[model samples]
Target: GFGWPVIEAQASSCPVICSSNGPLPEVAGDGALMAPAEEEEELARLLIQAIHSFSTRSELIERGLANVKRFIPEKITDAYIQLYTKLGS
Candidate 1:
């Protein structure tokens, strides 16, 4: 399942470094730096990069804010309703 922490981090104005496995990459969009699942070295490198650079961090925060727009509660509910209606039709 897609987790809520990704959006929460963005909502709090924090950049995220998470795994690209499963829905994470799709969910994160361009908002996060994603490492392959179980790749500790890559994840560590991304963390260091995010931590040491101001511009990159800022860019991620900006993109994260933009990405989270798709997941607003009303928009999500409407999408589900549309899907269900289409299926019923």
Candidate 2:
């Protein structure tokens, strides 16, 4: 029902540590640290790593923000216009 929070977190340059279920993986793309769904141990381990590993977390956050920005209205509109022009040709 909602995936915007994931995107927003990424946009704020925060790496997401999420349960590996639902549409979170899809929405997070390569910009998240996912743990096995319903597996507390795995989730805990990944979360710890995400929090403790500064470099990896920073990279994910940066990439995620960049990826999310690509879906912004202005950028999407520009892309649509380009596609339409190409199709019209």
Candidate 3:
């Protein structure tokens, strides 16, 4: 399954720090800073960076807003429709 929290944060214009596991990378795209799920230190570093650096934060916000568009209701519906059409054929 996809990471809905990542999409929600992106839509909310909040910076994201996510673990590099499962579908998180695909879900986050270029909108988030990711660390290995077991690497607490690295995740902390990314969290600090997101909090302190204005440029990084702004970039995350910008990219997140763009990345979130991929999951819009219309797009998801269209994708499902396409899949079902292909299956039906």
Question: Which candidate number would show the highest TM-score if scored against the true structure?
Answer: 3
Between candidates 1 and 2, the one scoring higher on TM-score is 1
TM-score, structure 1 vs. true = 0.90
**Residue 70: error of model 1 in Å?**
1.1
Q: Please give, for residues 1-89, the per-residue lDDT of candidate 1 as tens digits.
A: 88588988988889999998988888888999998978999999999999999999999999999999999999999999999999999
Residue 33 displacement in candidate 1 (angstroms): 0.2
What is candidate 3's lDDT per residue for 27-73, written digit by digit as tens?
Answer: 99999999999999999999999999999999999999999999989
TM-score of each: 0.90, 0.76, 0.92
lDDT of 3 at 43: 98
lDDT of each: 0.93, 0.84, 0.96
Pairs of residues clashing in candidate 3: none
- Greater TM-score among 1 and 3 belongs to 3
Q: Over 4 Å off in model 3, which ranges? A: none
Better of 1 and 2 by lDDT: 1
* Candidate 1 runs further than 4 Å off: none
